[model samples]
Target: MPSEHESFNTRMAKAMNDRDFQAYEALLTDDYVGEYPQSGEVIHGPKNARAIIEYYPGTLPRDTLDLKSARVGATEARWVRTPTFTVVRAEGTGNVGFSAMQSRYPDGSTWWVINFYELRGGRLARSTTYFAPLFEAPEWRKPYVEQRGPTADR
Candidate 1:
């Protein structure tokens, strides 16, 4: 049998794939903090996170999220989950967004929103994105583009 943490991650991914915001909302804690890359804004609380998702562009079609790998620890664990988001516009233009979430399973199955989503367009418009990191620690979190560097100190 899979661990509860693994099960929770799977369920969360499924809910997202289904575009069932209500279900997604259920997974989140009351004080969820969602980090938006494009805006450099951190949305505090579950209510705010839901509002942000509501304005997300491109109607979500197929929401198949696969758990690639997971690194478990005593208190906290980081998992690499990839959710392939298929979006379709009114003009019939389809685009795919791959979101790589690094979730920290605190208190076993209870998950927190550490990082996610690089928004595009001006506030309310289409967003085309690729694999983005979801940092667990606030201090470790930086601009997604910054992570792609060939500098002296990587």
Candidate 2:
């Protein structure tokens, strides 16, 4: 069973993955700011945040049925939607939190997103996020590292 208590990052991940703008907005402060350093873009407030989500391009045309291992209690279910994003890791202390996420694009490519969050008055005050596409490790480093776990195939 999932815990009754969830960290800020965990809730943020669920809100983002579900594309629940209302829940996302509730997590932020009135003066919330978000930055994307790669594009030198900055979002000043929740209104812009909603605009960004509404304007994001290339969403999946429709959700697919989950043909594998989706169950409710002991019964199989096929209507569940596959998650487009996964929170690989997240942690926080005091008023600071950070999360690493894996995002799957409509182009069939995967990217990593790292987010640094700051909280004030128990809500998000600022965020800095970075995005980078997945790449194969250079052959030169083959001897120095070991392939491990689920990510080994990537």
Candidate 1: worst-modelled 10 consecutive residues by lDDT? 88-97
User: For candidate 1, lDDT tens digit of each residue in 1-154?
Assistant: 7433334445555565555667766666665555556557766765666655543443232333222333222224443322333221111112212333332232223222332222222111222222333333344466443454432212
TM-score of each: 0.39, 0.74
Candidate 2 local lDDT, residue 3: 26
| lDDT of each residue in 1-154, candidate 2, tens digit only | 3321136667776665566668878888988999999999999998788657644553222233222322111125322232356678776777787778887654556789899988888678999999988877677988999856344244
Q: In candidate 2, what residue range of length 10 has the lowest lDDT sum? A: 66-75
Clashes of each: 1, 0
Candidate 1: regions farther than 4 A off: 36-39, 60-154
Candidate with the greatest TM-score versus the true structure: 2
Alpha-carbon lDDT of model 1: 0.39
- Please list the residue runs of candidate 2 whose C-alpha ends up more than 4 Å from where it truly belongs after superposition: 1-6, 59-83, 149-154
Clashes of 1: 1
* Candidate 2 TM-score over all chains jointly: 0.74
Residue 63 shift from truth in candidate 1, angstroms: 15
